[model samples]
Structure formats: C-alpha cells, structure tokens
Target: MPTPTRITPDSLRAAARTVLERDGRDGLTMQAVATALGVRAPSLYKHVRDRDDLVRVVVDDVSRELGDRLDVALADAGADAATAVRALAEVARRFAHEHPQGYALVFGPLPGSASPDRAALDHGAAALLEAARRLVGEEHALKAARTLTAWMHGFTSMELVGAFRLGGEVDAAWSYGLERIVAGLAADGRGRAG
Candidate 1:
C-alpha cells in the first residue's frame, strides 16, 4: 500500500512552476507536476480539471506575484513619475528573466476556451496603470500603460527567444529603449499639461 500524499492546490502550483521553470511550457505536464510532488498523475485530477486548468492556475499565481513585486518596487520609487515607470519596467524585466516560462504562460495568448484569472491579471495591470497615471495623468494613463507593456513584451519576448542576433550589448539597448520611452511619456505629459 502506498502512502497518501497531502497535495494541496498551492503545492500543485508550486510544483507546476518548478516544472515550468525547469522544462519550459512544452514540458509542463500533469505527470511531470505529480512526479515533482511525489504523487501519482491521477492525483492531480482531484485538484485541477485538466492540463489547461493547471496552466491557468500557474498563470494566476505568477500574475499575482508579478503584481506584488511591482507594487513593492513602486512603493520605493517616490513621487517622480519617470522613476516609477523605470522601476516598474525593471521589475517586469527581472521577473521575465527569472521565470521565462512562467512569464510566457502568464503573458502569452491562451486557448479560446481557457480563460485566465481576471483578478490576478487585473492586479498586475492596475500596478502598471497607476504608474502610467502618475507619468501621463488620467486621460492617457491606460494608453501609456498599454504602450509600456507592449514594448516590454516585444523586447523581452525577442530576448528570450535569442532573436536579437545583431545585438551590441543588449543591456545597453534595453536602457536606451526605456530612456527614450520615459522621455517620450514625459514630453507627452508636459504637452498635455501645457
């Protein structure tokens, strides 16, 4: 007789994240997660509906974590809007680098039938929106947030896939891009104010 495993949803998520970080998206399987938790593959079905459900769970967890980190980074950023934006961007980049597979799972497109956890997604977006509001004010905050997210997604996605073949110092490039975006946002805010 085998010992009963005390697997909770939280533990499942942690195991899934571990598998994701270790094997990337293609390798994140129910069997892999169960093995990580020292349980039979069938045991996971008790907690999650299917592989899609598992992915969604991990996505929500990662999204909430990203939100928490962004909030912390912003809290330490003081009143300067550019500084806040820079802080937000840096945290996002760091998170992406740290958990590339999880980053893709959270930010990448999902299947038509699989919906993400709205509150978790909103939590992260709200942090960015608040930072954008500080930078560009109320009228343009959402757009600014979208622009920043898109830029980060594009750059990070490319970097993750080793797409920057002609790169001469990727770190410098990221800094240059962030600086230009910040300057542009500041100018836009000034224009709106004046």
Candidate 2:
C-alpha cells in the first residue's frame, strides 16, 4: 500500500471518521486506520498520537456532528419549546439511527476515568447547554437542559440498541412525553415525570 503525500489533520480526521463509520469503535486502531488510508502504522502517529488520542478525536467528531444537528433543530424550532424539545429528541434518534456506533462512543463508558479530552467534552457540553438555553428560558434552562440531556440520551440509546423493540406506538409515547415536559417547563419550570 502507498501512503498519500498530502497528509493533513483534516484528512486524518476524515480517515478516522471513515474507519468509525465502517468499523465502530472496537474495530478502530492505529493499524486499522493506517490500513484504511493505505499508509503504514507509524505514519498514522503523525496524525493520531495514540489509540486513546485517536478515540478522543473520533468521539469528538461524532459529538460535534450531533451538536450541529441539534443546534439547527433548536433554532428552527423557534419559540415553540415543545417543537424544540421534540426536535432535539428526533435529532438524537436520528443520530442513533445513522451513527449508532458513534453514538455509543460518546454515551458509552470508558474503562476508567481517563479524563476525557477536556476540549472535546467541553465542546459537546457547550453545544447541548447552548441549545437548552435557546429552547427554554435562562431561569429554567439549567434544569430543562439536564432533563433534555438525560431523556433524549437514554431514549435514543434504548431505541438504537432495540431496548424498545417491544414497540407499538413508541413514537406516539415519545411525542406525548415531550409535549408534557414542555408544558411543565412553561407552566412551572419542571420536567414531566417519565
């Protein structure tokens, strides 16, 4: 295999993403990525420092993708908090549907407190928090943000892995629940009980 002469950070990240989409987290490796890019393993070192580092980059890539989608959804949602909330949920579901492995990479636990690459984590959290602030008011945004994160994350995680396989009208249930949560926020600044 021949290594391409034009190597760049963005190109490396693109290769990493391709490996992720084709192979999931477990299948990703310095060797695998190099192989995908038609380069030697050592050459990958120039782009991705180590396995952990590469994972962080890949995870950040997916997180940023989700963030961008949610950002647009929230903005398009306008003043309709219910629409905003539902849009968030739909984006999560779509993420799981389109990128289940990537979703797992973000939501799944690491073996230890490897102290996630702080920059990536902050970027991901900031995106979520910003969307929350936009959808709801500042006063209730914090709590609503927590609710939105937990609910959407859990619900979509379950949906992707078939935890909701016994489904019959699950979408309806999700919609109803989202509306009630929005109403609660609008009414008394609280999340509806699951």
Candidate 3:
C-alpha cells in the first residue's frame, strides 16, 4: 500500500513561515521547516524542490497575504485619494512591523532565478496602482505607484533594522513622510489635470 501523505505545500509553507519569523532568513532551512512540521528534512523535498524553492513558496504566500490586506485597506479607505494612499501605506508598515522577516523575504532580493508568484505580487501592485490612479490619474499612476513603493520600502527597511537612531517619535516621522508624498502627488494630479 502507498504511504499516506503527511505534509502538504500549505503546511510546509506555514512551518517555513514560523521558522523564518523565529530565526530570520538564514535560519530558514529545509531541516527547520521539516522539524516544525514533525517530518524529516528529506521529506520536504517531496513538496519543495530545495531550500530556494521553499523560500519562494514562503515569498509567494507572504506576497499574496500583503496584497489581500492592501486590497481590504483600500476598500475601507473611502473615496479620498489621500486617505486611500495613507491607508495602504499604513497597512504596509504594519505588515512589515508584524512580520519583519516575512516582509524582508517578500521585498528582499531572491536567491538564484526563483521568483515569487507573479499574480500574488501583482495583486498588491494593482492595489497600489489603483490608489495612484485616483491620486494622479492614469498617465502618472505608474510613476506614483513606484514612488510610493520606493518610499515605503526604504522606510520600512530602515525601521526593521532600527536604523532610525535619531530617536524622535518614529511614528511621527512616518506620518510626516507619508503626508508629504500624498500632498505632492495630489498637487501633481491637480497640476496635470489643469
């Protein structure tokens, strides 16, 4: 008789996420994930091709989750473009803070040629583009999205590393930066619309 399957891709990814969160990227090994799932390291190869493949799985999952949260935040942000932008940024920041390792994995450089799920990554990008479209019209939406993502990524990366050693209400600094970007985008939209 064939042996019963013990681990699914979902379970493997879940265990991998736990390992990543607890031990950071370097600690996320096949053995670690297998241990978390109560399986042997070799057993993980049945689900994932290798360690890089495993990381990609986790990355894809995190990307999808971030996209879902961004979508929900956008939905609840009302009709104001600025508010929508703020909501999206806040959601991203909170996600980063809550899942620093996962956030890094999603945003960090990938190993080898492995890529995260394109659809999953695009879900979040689409949400950002929608917000940007509202703020700056279709012509400039892509630029706005890129700009906002760059800012958010930089800020969160720094925050994650505790690089903001200047030490004066980091929350306020985040608000200040976000407001400036929103205002600038709104002004650009107005200027372009005129």
Candidate 4:
C-alpha cells in the first residue's frame, strides 16, 4: 500500500481555509480538506483532531491575518486617533467582504466558553482596543472599541448577506456611518475631558 501523503498542521489549515473561502462555513469538513489535498479523510486526523479542531485552527490563522491588517491600518493612520479608529473599522469591513466565509467563521457564531483559541481572537480585539484607547481615554476605551466593532460587524454582516434592500450606494452608507462614529467619539471625548 502507498504511504499516506505527509501533511503538516499549516497545510491542513491552508486547505481548510480554501474550503471555507470556496464553500463557506457549512462546507468545511475533513473530507473536503482531504479532497482539496488529494488525500483521504482519515489522513487529516494526523494533523488536526477533528472538524472543530480544524475550525479552531483555521479561525486562529484567519484572526492572525486580520490582526496583521489591523496593525497596518493603525500604523498608517499616524497621530490621528479618530482616523486610526476609522481605519481599523474600514479594515474590518474590507476583511469581511474579502473573506466572507472566514469572517463568518470567526464572527458569526459565538464560540464555546472553553474553546482553546481565544488568544487569537483576543489579539484582534486588543488591537482594536489599543487604537480606541488612544482616541478616547482608557476609561472609555472598551466602550469605544465595542461600538466600533459592533458597527463594523453589523454593517458588514448585513451587507454580505444581502440584507440591504435599498438602492443607494452601500459604500456611501458605510462611510457615513464611520463619519458619525468618529464625530460621536470626538464629542464624547471632549465632553468628558472638559
């Protein structure tokens, strides 16, 4: 009998990501990854424990990629805190649009309490919070970060699933919303500091 093709955890995660991008959240399975890798389903177990494990790994990888993007977006904003916050939101929106399936996997359903991959998700959240803190003092950082994330996630989720039936430009709506958020934060920041 021929030896099974050797596969690393990275290779498995890559194949899983491809499956996610092509077939979406529902289509990610060991069999699918195996098929993508031209191997048997059982062969995947050598790298990942099971479907959930594969998902955890894929989500971590995706989150890490997102963190990298957020880092760049934050860095490019220079000394403007509000712009940095907006830039992070824009990056999240673009990431959702570009990787809808991957985005859904991470942001759609709530993970279990004991999930082992919280760090990856936290890393992304921390990036946002750090940027937000720079804009609105540490006391209001969490709320600011949550508000930005909620807006980005809500808009992106709706836009991705065709929830917007209006004929107007959605991108325009997105920009408008970001503008409002920045304005609100600025007002709040000034109000609290005065």
Model 4: lDDT equals 0.86
Q: What's the candidate order when arranged by decreasing TM-score?
A: 1, 3, 4, 2
Report the number of the highest-TM-score candidate. Answer: 1
Candidate 3 yields a Cα-based lDDT of 0.91
Preferred candidate (TM-score higher): 2 or 4: 4
How do all models score by TM-score? Answer: 0.96, 0.82, 0.95, 0.93
Q: Please give the TM-score that candidate 2 achieves against the real structure.
A: 0.82
Model 3 residue runs over 4 Å out of place are 1-5
Model 4 residue runs over 4 Å out of place are 1-4, 110-116
RMSD each, Å: 1.2, 3.7, 2.1, 1.8
Clash count of each predicted structure: 0, 0, 0, 0
For candidate 4, the TM-score is 0.93
Model 2 poorest ten-residue lDDT run: 185-194
Per-residue accuracy of model 1 over 1-194 as CA lDDT, tens digit each: 88887998789989999999999888989999999999889999999988988888888899999999999989999989999999999999999999999999888888755567899999988888998999899999999999999999999999999999995999999999999999999899989988
Cα lDDT computed for each candidate against the true fold:
0.92, 0.73, 0.91, 0.86
Candidate 2 displacement at residue 147 in angstroms? 1.2
Per-residue lDDT of model 4, residues 38-70, tens digit only: 899998887787788888888888998998899
